[model samples]
Target chain A: MSAPTLPDLSGHFGRYGGRFVPEALVRALDELDAAYRTAKTDPEFQAQFKDLLLNYAGTPSLLYRAERLSARLGAEILLKREDLNHTGAHKVRNVLGQALLAKRMGKPRVIAETGAGQHGVASATAAALLDLECVVYMGETDTERQALNVARMRMLGATVVPVTNGSRTLKDALNEALRDWVASVDTTHYLLGTAAGPHPFPEIVRDFVGGIGIEARQQCLDQLGRLPDAVAACVGGGSNAIGIFHAFVPDESVQLYGFEAGGDGVATGRHAASITGGSSGVLHGARTYVLQDEDGQTVESHSISAGLDYPGVGPEHAWLHDTGRAEYEPVTDAEAMAAFQLLCRTEGIIPAIESAHALAGAARIVPALREELGRTPTIVVNLSGRGDKDVHTAGAYFGILDPVETLVPGENS
Target chain B: MSIAEIFAKARAEERALLIGCMPAGFPTVDDSIESMIAMHEAGCDVIEVELPYSDPVMDGPVIQKASDIALGRGVRTRDTLRIIEAVAGAGATVVLMTYWNPIEKYGVNAFARDLAAAGATGMITPDLIPDEAAEWIAASDEHRIDRTFLVSPSSTDERIAMTVAQCRGFVYATALMGVTGARTSVSSQAPDLVERVRHANPDMPVGVGLGVGNGAQAAEVAGFADGVIVGSALIRCVLDAPDRATGLSRLRALSAELAEGVRNPAK
Candidate 1:
């Protein structure tokens, strides 16, 4: 077979991907580009990483088949239990890899942009482990919604700066993070939450995330004697998808599907469906595809799930779609919410809204499997995190919880 | 080779796409299109028409204010596409330079088709990162719209080589470490930066932009680079002028001045 097309460093996946950063941050990027190459080869770093994942962060996270859900949906359901990860979610997996890379690069502090607070928590977790100063940029709005996460980051000794500018959301927080990074290019490393950003971030984060595929591929083979037919995951800056998609890319048999947040509906003016819907442009320092105006301003996105509400996606996804390696689709807010409730009832598993995108997509995929193949096929849905944190929003939507005015007895966290 | 031929002749000379900072719908869609026409008329390689966003942290005050005015005046994609059509009517090569959100809202493939139909040769969204380029780039390429990518000085030798290979038009070489602005001193390390680029790509023309102000700086940058890009300086000129003719004339004059500087950098 011909060699897989190597992704270029400008981060292009066949005309997508680029460094769209501020001028001040160029040196830092260059420094990172240089340090990452050296650090990747260091056995010491690898040994330390291996030790952390195995000991502190629980290596080889279990891939449990969702037998009941599979039977119910008429297709095999597998769970890549990233929830078993330390501090929950697959965000820590990336943070650990980057924080270690940062330590090797001799950076003083680690910076991050957070939405639902999972990334902030994970970054704080990594910083605490590595003894690095952590500064996580969170939007004021997000801080209000994910108050516990805000407090959690602070409790972990991280400085949480709420971004009050520009719609006061995740994207705005990202702008502030990039600004801080630009101002202090030398001493800080942006521990990006997802596989979005510029060249090295997409490539490096994907490398770190390949562990998921490695573990899952082996587990599937050991259990079922062959790789699963398809693997699906939620796309928020698309880290989980990258984590699951990397090892499977070379395996032509195992299909990869990434589900984006479609918000109220694709018909409505709300959603974060960048790959399935967005146009080509730049944001946060990479020229991939993003939701923007004809003038290049980032457009605001809406989703019931805050984590998957981001308007841009990773560049490699652009490459994948261009090359036809992976297929991306949007999962609407109602459908995701229904899936969220469905998972809670079916498997006693409450999933984060971002991960709910995968469940919602999987819900659709299950019915199609029976008609298409005439056999129930095994599939893995990366349960990225437990939905313990997003209970407030979930409760509000179903009217299970009260509005902000009068608090219930146990509502005061 | 001819200037237009150079841009078209991707194999020979490095194709450079020119992006101008003008408030969309400003001076009127007609005026904006005329400026695009003027850039093309004055031998600009490829036109990057910015859709002025209000909170453009990436841009300096000039482009930032232009973004505000354009966006504040409600210059939507429809208006910008009208401008693209007008520019194409003027027989100019054009592309859309914007952030990603609006395009995402518009739908990727539809946007690509609309842009290509409006006669846009390509797009330059500085913020659509590499990992997310799959849908937009793929759909656009299928529709025959080239996507331009940015390459910074901080980009490694390997990455620069990668960008030089992947990017369809010329590489946008940022001149300094800040947003686009007028600087008194041309980045002192510009010649060396140009030399470094030359070592990596002895072929492609690097468009030296950001921080370049006067003809002297332009000329100095031209000494080591292929083209001198003046954004804030020219935009500032248009904003300062009272009327359209004066602004257009000033734009032409600056273009000529910068071109002259490129020809004789020692001066």
Candidate 2:
């Protein structure tokens, strides 16, 4: 079969993605589109991006088989270990590509928005390595929760601006970043952190990060002697999912699954299940499924994992769900936390709460597949990040530290 | 009167058209209508009623705060239309300004029909360009509603021509390349952008917004454009007021000052 292609000239992924920004950003988007088109073909640019991915960010992350969990669940489970990448997530790949592209385009500075601070740290790292002025806009709430990430970004020489608007989360940070981009488009590139936003951004992010799928596909063939039956990844803005799913799009034998943050549950109206529960709308310059109310005001999404606490997913995910190219399921906080602990106990791997959502989704479906097929179905879950950043939240959730800390006395004891 | 007619009349009188903006249901729905009507009576030739949105990316802090208040108060699209109906009933040339999502969600044709029924003469869609606005263009044309598109300083000549061709009212020349806020100095790029718009279509009226705050700034923009649009500064007048009455009076005073400045550019 021919290679999978999407997002026609107008940037529509089957009526999903489009340029929904103000007129001030049109020229900048056009320029970025042209520059990316040219840079993708330039051998020097390709070599530089590849060098950074391999040498600096450490690409070709491990694909480990969770033998204990697989044996217990009566299914074969494999993990694409993006958590091992430098900065502890898959965000660095895209950031490195965009930052290099910024330099190639003669842009001296870059800006980005981060939620869990994973993207912010990755962007800061790229900026430091590339010698470009970097700024990261984060929600005020996020800065307080992800304090370690804030310090890391500052240490990397990227200014972290806390946005206090709206819900004071990823969406608000995105709004501030877009405002900055509009003002500084001539000299700065808005390094969008996800496979979202207007036109070239979603496509560009997917292409740069598609290396995950490219490597995983080859690894699956060499290591497993065949492709996996299903691939699963958590969907916030769906960058990692798209990155890993892009290479498998033309493989008709593979089934793709995207696990959205269910928070409490979709029925309780407190989840970020844009595909599972949302309607079609526009947010952050892209037409996609959004968590909005009756008046079309974007609703606040609640999730224990800051990385997945967004009201919208990338537009291509919406199109994929509509076209039946992929299936999306909501993974509740309880289910994800359970899977997080299970992965820790069984496999000696502490997955990010966001990645745990994908694990939870795989757990939900694997038992059924085992029952139906009466055989082990190989499942690949994209472990998008490490749980190091989420240790505090996990400890609080499991009450692991509270009882112990309370048992110990204060300084007097 | 049509938006074009307002600009033509202002041109014939050798003065720039003074356009005042206020978000609908700000402070409160009734109070916002009263404040806008007061500004129109004082001197505003055209009143742009902003439909408050949850995520107003193009707006500055002042306008964002105002919109937050309005949305927090349970203001809906229907309430914004009521403000337009009341303001237009008071003999003000009313235009609805909003981001594109609300209109898309509200149904473009339905929004156009309701806007026309409320006596609004035009729309200023900040986020909607001509290329992606075929639905809105058809709707507006069907309702005979004027469509005003924004042109920024960074806009290329080709972009300027395309935007102006789709504009039915005056082309909204963004004074600077930033979100809306009152500034101390009008952007140096404003006149050049206005000239570029004129070169594309001389008959198309050009209105500059995104920075004009006080009378002096209005006069500076008035020297080169057909309309001076002020938003964040006017909202700030109400926001800083001690009471609703004080806000209305301050808005009137600011409107009168800006109106005078537009008429007497040499001052």
Error of 2 at A161 (Å): 0.8
lDDT of 2 by residue, A1-413 (tens): 23256787778898889988899999999999999999989999999999988998889899999999898766789999999999999999999999999999999999999998999999999999999999999999999999999999999999999999998999999999999999999999999999999999999999999999999999999998999988999999999999999999888888899999999999999998988978999899989999998778899999999999999989999999988989999999999999999999999999999999999999999977777667789999999999999999999999887644445457565
What docking grade does candidate 1 earn?
incorrect
Screening candidate 2 with a backbone cut-off below 3 angstroms (N, C-alpha, C), the clashing residue pairs are none
Candidate 2: residue A380 lDDT (0-100): 92
DockQ of each: 0.19, 0.83
Question: Candidate 2: lDDT of B15?
Answer: 94
Q: Which stretches of candidate 1 lie over 4 Å from their true place?
A: A1-5, A20-27, A280-282, A293-297, A403-413, B1-51, B54-57, B60-66, B76-176, B180-267
Error of 1 at A343 (Å): 1.6
* Candidate 2 C-alpha error for residue B41, in Å: 0.5
Angstrom error of the Cα, residue A316, model 1: value is 2.1
Q: What tens digits encode model 2's per-residue C-alpha lDDT throughout B1-267? A: 999888899989999999999999998999999989999998999999999998998999999999999999999999999999999999999999999888989999999999999999999999888878899999999998999999999899999999999999888999899999999899999999999999999999999999998999888889999999999999998999998888888999999999998998643
